[model samples]
Target: MEKHPRVKLHFTLTRSSWLNVIERWTGQPERNTLYHGCFTSVKDLRETIKIFIDSHNTHSAKPFRWSQAADAILASVDPARTSMILNS
Candidate 1:
């Protein structure tokens, strides 16, 4: 770190990956079907959830795209830079 002072570090808590997946997957169904929904019995709740999932699955889900274009990042660096962004 001392040798390359311009670099920065970010830290993530252990097991954070599951938390991200759980949040993304549950948000839509929870918002539309489960949140504040009234069901008369256990069977009613399960049936509603099953229907919601089946309906949701009919629509195609898009793949996550990772476009790691570095142009914008490099542009943000100061013009008075000395060292190359990547060391040889």
Candidate 2:
């Protein structure tokens, strides 16, 4: 890392929050199009996924909105709130 002075590194303590958002978004197609559907071969599955991605990108893709304030997000995951959720 020291060899590349211009490069910066970012580390996450847990799964990337952005990755969770992406997974949630991609999961829709998995549930709606892939699940319980039969594919004759690897190519078929690839094509299906491609078609779904293309359709989504062309029709339903939208810029993600971050409406929640950071404080609100922090509050929701505070230790006290986590304990309450776990105990319940």
Give the best candidate by TM-score.
Answer: 2
- The parts of candidate 2 lying over 4 Å away from their true place are 1-15, 63-88
Runs off by more than 4 Å, candidate 1: 1-19, 62-88
Global lDDT of each candidate: 0.69, 0.80
Clashing pairs in 2: none
RMSD of 2: 12.7
Q: Write the per-residue lDDT of candidate 1 for residues 1-88, one digit (tens) a residue.
A: 8467787654334446758876887787788889989989999999988888788777745566645557864564434233333422
- Put down candidate 2 lDDT per residue, 10-76, tens digits, no spaces: 5334546878778898898789899988999999999999999999889989977868998987976
TM-score of 1: 0.45
Error of 2 at 86 (Å): 33
Model 1: per-residue Cα lDDT at residue 65: 63
Q: After superposition, how far is residue 21 of candidate 1 from its true place, in Å?
A: 3.1
> How much lDDT does candidate 1 score?
0.69
